[model samples]
Target: MMTFIESVQQALQYDFILKALLVGSLIAVSASVLGLFLVLKKYSMIGDGLAHVSFATVAIALWMSASPLLVSIPIVILASFFILKLSEKASMHGDAAISLVSSFSIAMAVLIASMARGFNVDLMSYLFGSILVISNFDVVISAVLSLVVIVTVIFFYHDLFAVTYDEEYAQAVGMNTKFYNYLLAVLTSITIALGIRIVGTMLISSLIVFPTVTALQVSRGFRTTILIATLISVICVILGVLFSFAYNLPTGAVIVLMNAIAFGLAFLAKLLRR
Candidate 1:
């Protein structure tokens, strides 16, 4: 155990590990904050939806030798809007809309890879995540976007809460419910895209869902839930980074497993309190 702690300490001294930890912390906080609203609103899977869209966009960007962040963010944002429109206008369920878009996007991803033949290790890194090899450009992009998400959530907290908890009430009170819904989807899209580095598209939704749901297991009040979720997410990222380094495991998967363990413990604690 001491050797493990020493190795993690050694890993933290490196620049890349520090960058990964910084980016992971930012993403975790933003994801947890936004996720509380989304989970309450029953849109928890939107991250998964946007992750699928990002997969397609990343494939195209890699095939074109373009910046993945530049390409993925815009395309995923558009897909989020599309999902929102489908849910609102087409009389479709939100989950159904997400499923349709995500399924199509994943298909497009495979098709793009098949036709363009850009199935390299770089592509795999984006799919499964490789924070250890994340570039300086990716670090900058992730940091900026994660901060944008955190700031946006802070600025629009009440409006977002209104829309999430009771959209009809918000609309009846003369709030622009439509705009808030679109804004939520947009922020979620950005969060999902940014998470590609820390957790990968395949598992990024867990970053949002696990923390929020785990918080729900223990907290009854909305504010308390958010605080607990954010705490859980931040701790998970820190521990995940350290353990992944000490054991040479995949950081993304380890972080997810850490969240699962947190959720399990939260559930047990809830039972004990009963």
Candidate 2:
């Protein structure tokens, strides 16, 4: 139904769409792999909480006139540290603490954004995502960060796998699981910041959790799960981008929805087989 000239015009007018697709697919791939461990560890909600922290940091960055990345780095790093410390207290459940922090962070973001004028419009894009508005700088930063996330995950794969399979044994074997946990939190924070411009605070976590979750429901092996999740995420991103382009819809939301659909279909398939 589409002609070559129409396709070319669409591509030219939406160059940012290509940029968003590239960055999002890369993000989806890495996040899907990383998310397998997070889901296995029962810390999937941490990704959602970290996104809220990023929202608050973005507000602070606007207030201070500093680069959002620089400002978000310390804030999220500290938040991650505190989360780790709280998890150790033995009195508070990790999920409860994560929920409290996520709520508080989002409230603070709203209050801060309301207090500051002229940032609300720009802020909306970050909240809901403007994939078509991704900048050259954002593309470069995302590419480099994706590389870092991928390399770190690969280098630590064995240790992470051991820890996930059995934290008790990992501790008995002298693997400082505490350190790896903190490291993962830091990595997640960085990924959240890197993802804001592409998927925004609200929807970024779908990229992190959905693909891995879906893959986990189907694949028996961890490596296979990661590979399948990455593939699924790429397809979701591509479809989401095209759907957005045709419908003039929000790209991140469309992508996330596609992911949800994939999850539903996978779940249905599993149920039918059973």
TM-score per candidate, in order? 0.98, 0.93
| Number of the top-ranking candidate, with TM-score as the measure | 1
**Leading candidate by lDDT:** 1
Deviation from truth (RMSD, Å), model 1:
1.0
Candidate 1 lDDT over residue span 1-274, tens digit each: 9999899889978999999898899989989999888888889989998999998999999999999989998899999999988998999999999999999999998888888774666778888887777789988988898898889888998889888888898999999998888888888888888888888889999999999999999988888899999999999998998899999899999999999999999999999999
Tens digits of per-residue lDDT for model 2, 119-162: 88888888987877777877887888888888999999998898
Q: How close is candidate 2 to the true structure, as a TM-score?
A: 0.93
Model 1, residue 78: distance off in Å is 0.4
Worst 10 residues of 1 by lDDT: 115-124
Error of 1 at 111 (Å): 0.9
Those runs of model 1 whose alpha carbons end farther than 4 Å from true positions after fitting are: none
